[model samples]
Target: MNTSPRILVVEDDRTVRTVVNDYLSGQGFSVTAVDNGSEVLARFAAERPALVVLDRMLPGLSGDEVCRALRATSDVPIIMLTALDAVPDRIAGLESGADDYLAKPFALKELKLRIEALLRRSRQAGAAPSEFGLGPFRVDPARRHIRRDGVPIPLTTREYELFLYLLNNPGRTISRDEILREVWQWQFGDPSTVTVHIRRLREKIEEDPRFPVHLKTEWGSGYRFDLRGGEG
Candidate 1:
């Protein structure tokens, strides 16, 4: 009975790939390493890893393309590795459906921590609350499904977790740092990832994302989800 989590590492850099493989293996993960984006989908299907470490710049499919494809059908957690350290590039990666992002030259220890956080959050979210009816939305925790007005709104794992957290504490202002701590389980992170997930979730759940009614920003504080939206 093997309890170690299986991980898929999709990276083209040989040295980085070896280093990561050895580190994660030492950290007690079952790792399957692949070199090209072309083989990612196939290997992913075969390995069925608990999480994916995807390189943003790949020769064949590109990480964004792979992320989009994975998001279409699977809610697996993805941490995109990239050399692009720009904020816009990070936003693009988040919006493309990665659960997290790590710029190249990232600390392997930090990457391990991020992976642990994501897997822990996922396990907790899946453990209970088979169903939740929040205002006009239905959140199925067991299946990781969310629906609004009887229409399914596709959400990445992070988006779903964020939405669920906000819904659970509706009408209360949650600071960005608090969200990062509670939702992402990160003591310190880029924080922009939270912003991107919130923006994407607004597009799905809000009638008007520009002037969102349910998910509202508190200017200086953070955000509040009015589960009692369109009501007094």
Candidate 2:
């Protein structure tokens, strides 16, 4: 029985793809490498990999497009690789359904570490049967699903992790640095990543994102998630 976790690598660059595939395989993962974006969905459907390492530029359907398509039906973690190193480009990748992003010329060791972290989190979330309530919302961690007032609330993989982290530690202010370290499992990275995810969470959880109540920013500190919202 080959029980090793499967990883799908999507990169147009042959050298990068081959290197990543070999590296991940050496790291004890079962890797499937693809060169074109168009093949991503088919491979995903067939393999149902534990994670996907996708390049932003590809021969067919761009990375963003493939990401969006995958997100429509699955919450499998995606790490986007791109040549664009600007803050906005990273943010755009996250917005396009990537759970994490790495720029071109990245260290292979860091990529491996991130893959381990995401896979660990995914396994933990799935194996644990945690059901809880936050105000009107119901969280089922085992299923990676949440609902409010009988309606399902859609959340990206990162958003769900962030929400659950806050819910588990209620009332205490969680610093963005702590969030990056804990939720993202990154010792250092753009704080804006946390900011972007928090904003997206507020939109889905708050009655009015413009004046959020449950997920409150502590100005110079960080954020706190509450069960009840203040009066509008």
Candidate 3:
């Protein structure tokens, strides 16, 4: 039998942690639970989970901080859990490198769906090739490495997958719903999550993230990956 997918849960709340852990395990996942941001990196290195459920408010290291730090080294998928409902707060989480987000007091079913969606995307992206180039960035999918102007730029697993998706479909506008389905494998659409990942991708790949030349926003639509160096 195949080993269950490993999941790392980084939340300070005991009740929330237990609920997620128990629920995911019952769904046939292997879970490692940890509290505080301080331990996330170490646990991640050791556990090498297939995905991470990280809380936005963490002791020692904030969820965003942890996500950013992890992005600097690895491409592990991270889904942030937070109580903040503000748009800015959601953006902040995405900008900090989270792959997806879930507001607190969320339904367990929703969380399960998100986890499964992320995992499916990861698996699909991994099974494909290891080399892709778009704009100024080049990615070796087999090695899971990305470089800009020949200088290595590290990306987490989710970031790499997002980048790959954009590269594979340049110039065409991809709706948030499509991104959710293709990148997150979410049948139930989540535009907020798509927005966050796109924002984070811009920060990593664009020389000027505030005015990106590659990842272009489509105003009322979603986003387009401009590979020809032209503004959308």
Query: Per-residue CA lDDT of candidate 2, range 2-80, in tens?
Result: 9999999999998999999998899899999999998999999999999999998887799999999999999899999
Compute the lDDT for candidate 3.
Answer: 0.83
Question: Model 1, range 174-221, lDDT digits (tens) per residue?
Answer: 998899989887788787888999999998888889988888888888
TM-score winner between 2 and 3, please give it: 2
Predicted candidate 2, C-alpha RMSD? 1.9
Whole-structure CA lDDT of model 1: 0.88
Off by over 4 Å in 2: 126-130
Tell me the TM-score of model 3: 0.81
lDDT of 3 by residue, 1-232 (tens): 7599999999999999999999999999999999899998998998788999999999898999998888777777888898997888988888887877888889989888878877776676467685767667787766767788798867666777777788889899998888877877667754876777777777777888999988899888888888776854
Candidate 1: worst-modelled 10 consecutive residues by lDDT: 223-232
Number of the predicted model whose TM-score against the real structure is largest: 2
**What's the TM for model 2?**
0.91
- Give the lDDT of residue 22 in candidate 2: 92
Q: Each candidate's TM vs. the true structure?
A: 0.90, 0.91, 0.81
After the best TM-score superposition of candidate 3, give how far the Cα of residue 194 lies from its true spot, in angstroms. 3.1
- Summed backbone clashes in each candidate are 0, 0, 4
Between candidates 1 and 3, the TM-score winner? 1
